[model samples]
Target: MKVWKSVVSAALVSVLLAGCGSNAGTDNEQNEVKAGSTVNLKVFVAQPRLKEHYDKYIEQFKAKEKADKNIEVNVQLEMPPADNAPQILKTRLASNDAPDVFALHAVNEIPPFSKAGYLEDLSNQPFVDKLLDSVKPSVTDASGKVVAVPLETLSWGYLYNKDIFKEQGLEVPTTLTEMKAVVEKLKAAGITPFELSYKEAWVPQLFLPLTVGALTQTEHKDFVEKMNKDEASFSDMKALFDVFDLVNANGTDKALEVGADDGAAAYATGKAAMWIQGPWYAETILKSNPDVNFGVAPMPLNDNPDDTKINLSTSTSLAVSSSSKNKEVALDFVNYILDDKDSSAFYEALKFNPVAKVHTFKSFPWVDDALKYVNEGKAYQDPKIPQAVKDESGKALQGYYSGQLNQQQVIDALDKAWKSYNKVNK
Candidate 1:
């Protein structure tokens, strides 16, 4: 049988294969390999939600390796929550015990690692040609090399319960004024217009990206550049604060106490009409309430309908370790996952929109709608801002949500953080 077919078959029989006791070792024992032995490659993946799918793909990868190379391959799969993986991976890399392969965010996450000489350059790989041109910028490094295989493109917006909107006789809002009016109507009907989970600092900050994209579409195309150069401040973007105020004023009571999981559950159970998030929460929401019909749309940012645009970019990419003992095997495995015949299955398993040109995604109406922006080049991805600035921005947004910092204070804090970060990083 061909490798791809064998991989598909292995996926089917993965449960039985799970008991085979693959001899993959941990980072502590990675260097203790016997002479003339099977290859072992450790793969660190951050998507805890897709552990099963990754495990199945790894099994398929192993089966294919044995068939094609006549050498047994043991893949040690390390699964971690998205929130904690980067720090752990960083520690491991700094200690010279990096995994053979790992998943990382394309932009802000790649630079430090790549500059530190921890990532292998995959620019000339065949898989690089398969990626959607639109996503190439995010995965490309300062050296003009594609350092990773982009696995999925993600878009953030408002996930609204279509059923609730239809029953309430409300059209999906396309402008900020319309959105505020809809919120009032929903509130009048005793429904929470927006679900805010400010306890999870990142949740409240979701509004920023959509707001940023809308600003870029209207008047701030050089926003990221100016911010990086210290020539502009978040205060310059008053529209973002206006949108933040609209969302905070319309959120559920006790929203400051809600976490991401609780907020998702609330939206899933019809406790709220809207939740600002990306496609990452779709599975969780569907699992919570399979019958609830939902769709995603750009966050309406102003009175002009055309000003709204989705924030789209390569959300995850796979990269090989520069210091790996098994670089050849790692490269092969990365290529296998992205090959035309296998890429769709890998993406489908994660329920993510594919970044490869070989696949087509039509699963969700909101995803389809987001694709229209992508095709028309109406989407936006923030440039490579310093990690310190990114982290501080989240805190600033949370403070705004809690009224602990006024609008100007939040902007000042971010501007200060950005300047300080540039001094050190530059």
Candidate 2:
């Protein structure tokens, strides 16, 4: 999910031929020529790791579009690098000449683009009917403009080696104290109970939510929407540092000694008993050994043992360019991939939870419980601050991860970033 490939932040654009995509003779003739000799459909994505899925989808799309006598589809794919996608997409969108379809890393990216009239409004579009009610909000603008289609969702949680649990005769901690005790117990057994990497810098900062979820008992499931209204403040982010204190108390920085990739590797090899990661950890850890028995659970609420709530509340989204001369065709292509029925196979291949009518929690049992929880009126989207705030947060966390700042300093920096970033747009 976070590892999706090359995009700048939401600032992206793509020039279209006069008739880049339209029927040879149709009322929407403006879009009729996208495929003159060949209709070129350029797309941007975040998950390059999921290329196989896109390649297959493209092949199918090409076949279907070519079957039509009037239009042809050419698929050009690109993704943003691992870090700073929000930054990259922002740059591209500002450049004016960008891609036809691109991924929106978060709902926040869509607003500025929507304000700029850069994304197509699909609220009343046919594809809007096919998405799950739960997924639609992530793509809609404040004006309720549907700038993108909901693809799949990514949830966050703590993943532990079930085998390790059994070996230690430890039950999954349901209470806050027990959770920390579990960490302590594992450490006493000469095991690092958690995995963390400061090199990527954002790693530990990202995990702060696990603690926040535990602390609030998941009361702030709408943290994003609330933050959007200027009601929330990152300056009050002492909650975040409290979460990191667990990592510090446990002296788990040994894992931080490694890079993000290697820290996950350590977990895969059984050197670490627990990990705070999202579903992507499945693929990352599996690379070493798919057989590693891991169990997924919501991050402890307020560290509450029995509180089994907190939504892994966000997803990367897919959207069409407003400049597309082939509006109808582009919409059709996006709908073909994201609509309920088609999205089942699409979600399976992409390994994300389906947010479309076609997806079932059962289809992704690994992530099902989390998605089910989200659909059942739980989960919260990540706070989508302005580009400035986001980069500031990332940089601040990077500093935290690298031990460049002490705990209080980390919180202060986030407060500064959030305020400064929000100030510009305000």
Please name the candidate that would achieve the greatest lDDT relative to the true structure: 1
Counting only residues 3 or more apart in sequence or on different chains, how many pairs clash (N, Cα, C under 3 Å) in candidate 2? 45
Task: Candidate 2: list runs displaced more than 4 Å.
Answer: 1-29, 34-36, 208-235, 248-265, 301-308, 325-329, 339-342, 371-387
Can you write out model 1's per-residue Cα lDDT over 8-42, one digit (the tens) per residue?
21121222223123211222222443434599789
Candidate 1: list runs displaced more than 4 Å. Answer: 1-36, 360-363, 374-378
The most accurate candidate by TM-score is 1
- For residues 137-201, could you state the per-residue lDDT of candidate 2 as single tens digits? 87888897777876656676767888899999998765557778888889888988777665554
Residue pairs in steric clash, candidate 1?
A: none
Each model's TM-score, in the order given? 0.84, 0.80
Cα lDDT of model 1 overall?
Answer: 0.72
